[model samples]
Target: MSNEYLYIKVDKNSMAKNKVVYLEDIAKLYSTDTDKINILKKQVVLTIKDNKPIKCVFSILKIIEIIHSIYPDVQVINLGESDFIIQYQPKKERQILKYLKIVMVSLIIFFGSAFAIMTFNEDASVEEVFKKIYELIMGSEKEGGTILEISYSIGIPIGIIVFYNHFSKVKLSNDPTPLKVQMRVYEEELDKTLIANASREDKIIDVD
Candidate 1:
């Protein structure tokens, strides 16, 4: 390879679908030398052991050193994060386990939300309020089944749909749901925490 510069753009976080990770898996190459780029793409970068999922942080400094050692004449330019994380996970997970987890989480959410709503209603004396409203409008005492109670029951779910901006697979708008936004924030924080802890855990890949 002639003495030339190669530009690589990498994100702060990347996913490796399999145990083995390559240069192409984490970084985008920008160079005129297709052959050299191909060679670099095939280079072994990281491998997960025991067929287990893992996340590891790596510094681009060591990567640059490695590239320079291989092609001393070629300069490597970094156009992305100085350090990044590669999360290794298998593409195919156990279907039964996956479904089981989903079911379990769904059940928990259902029960938990039901409990919260019930507790709130009890605290606010919703039954007494409904009875008074019923008496005031109908000029009589309210029994168990009334339009007020029915409407309140229906309105709870509708309010949830409007507040959450989601129901089943349907979306009320283009904006992401509150749950999705929170999950994304959680994932971003997790990635940052993992990257920050890598060096302390002696799991950071860097120049020796």
Candidate 2:
């Protein structure tokens, strides 16, 4: 998946006074980074950082407040951030269920046809008997009296086992869908915050 980078342009003078804010501090304020980002200069030039669309946009507003608080005549413009949303392909549960159904049905058809061939041809070879039975159940031929007897006696039970076995293994062991997406976003946000806090502390230490 593609990630987005949010850019906020502060005044040159403000930036000259400070440097750049940590990316982590911006992420902590915003939940996601899905917005237009950019940087510009008019009165003073500060710094730009990454943040989510909704939160970062709002954060910029607060930033304007902070700028105006100090430099009342400062010119601030929202250069806007860049947004990148990657399209993802995810498998649906229905596809898995449909595949299983086809397999189970195919097995039942095979077993039914075998039973029919065995009933009709008393002298038929084992393979031939199975083939004829397969054709009959597939609606290719009419069922004979012998086929009816074989089906009730054995075919039904075999069908049940085949279906049960196929269905039992339908679920996959490693499915990366819901949880993975959420976790990725969470981890990214956390990492950003940690980096920002560390940078801020470094600046304080330098000042001291």
Candidate 3:
């Protein structure tokens, strides 16, 4: 295996489901020799013993060193990111806590959005504008629960649904929802930040 080549492709970020993360969990490995590929896949990349959220960045050079320890002259090819972040989040089986969290977030989002909408409407004087339009249209004073109010109430939810492009597991299109897009952007940004900090702080695992 002196002249053999091993190819590795690693993502910028990965999530470890188990406490022990293997090479195959964070990266894709390939080699002409099936035996080498099989063994390489099981190589321990990292171990998580702490029962808390752990974020660490790893350099590809460390992986090369691991392979070199096994096959000294094997050429290692990296086709992915030079540095990648592995985040380990330990799972807890607290059903009540999970439901409580869900309820709290639901309440916060519900009330927060309602407050924002109300403030916007007040600032814009939506009711006054609606009443003016109603007077001009019907030649009379507008009462509560008029067609304008009913349509406004009905249209708000529909508009929100269309704008968000998602509702209760229902997808309006094949494109990703706005929330998912924002979350993805946030994850990528966070990974970059962690990787940069690791490099600057000299905490990233890399070979000499």
Candidate 4:
């Protein structure tokens, strides 16, 4: 195939002053022996005598510095064609409310099912199951709805207090303090690596 040539309008000021050299001219200088010269839209190409073709299409300034250091007499001629690389990243949301809703609904369904099973037991009445639950909770073996009546007046508030206290003790670490959970996780990972890499002599051998 016939080699295609691009007529690059050489900058008079750059060549005259010998200040900032354009990269496009570098390719043409090298193309005297080779026909694979291309002038990409935004790039600057540079080639030094007896050296590999230096493709400098992105940063014209950096390319000029490189060329002047190696071949001070050489001027940039043309930039070469290169594949542009790009990457994309996705954002993640820590939706605590969404997670909490799912957990709470699951808990309610599970507990409600247990409640239903207990209430519909062959020997136990709805009143009886509630009475048993109350007795278990209130530390009372009362034979009547005295516990239920008490629970309606006082037990609901007491249950709420108990639940609040338990919830507080759950230690979700929601406070603004910077806990080293990541460090602990790293330590666990290190331990796993150590276990995986341990020599047979270093491992605890189970003697029968």
| Model 3 CA deviation exceeding 4 Å by range | 1-3
RMSD of 2: 18.7
TM-score of each: 0.86, 0.18, 0.93, 0.20
Q: Given candidate 2, what's the lDDT at residue 68?
A: 53
TM-score-superior candidate, 2 or 4: 4
Per-model lDDT:
0.86, 0.42, 0.91, 0.42
Ranking by lDDT: 3, 1, 2, 4
* Candidate 1 lDDT tens digits, 2-29: 5588998889899897677888989898
- Between candidates 1 and 4, the lDDT winner: 1
Report how far off residue 21 is in candidate 2 (Å): 9.4
Using alpha carbons, what is the TM-score of model 2?
0.18
How many clashing pairs per prediction, in order?
Answer: 0, 24, 0, 15
Candidate 4 structure quality by residue, lDDT tens digits, 42-145: 24332223222221122234444544454455445435311111111222346997898889998997798667666665355656667777778879777755
By the TM-score metric, which is better: model 3 or model 4? 3
Comparison by lDDT, 1 against 3, better one: 3
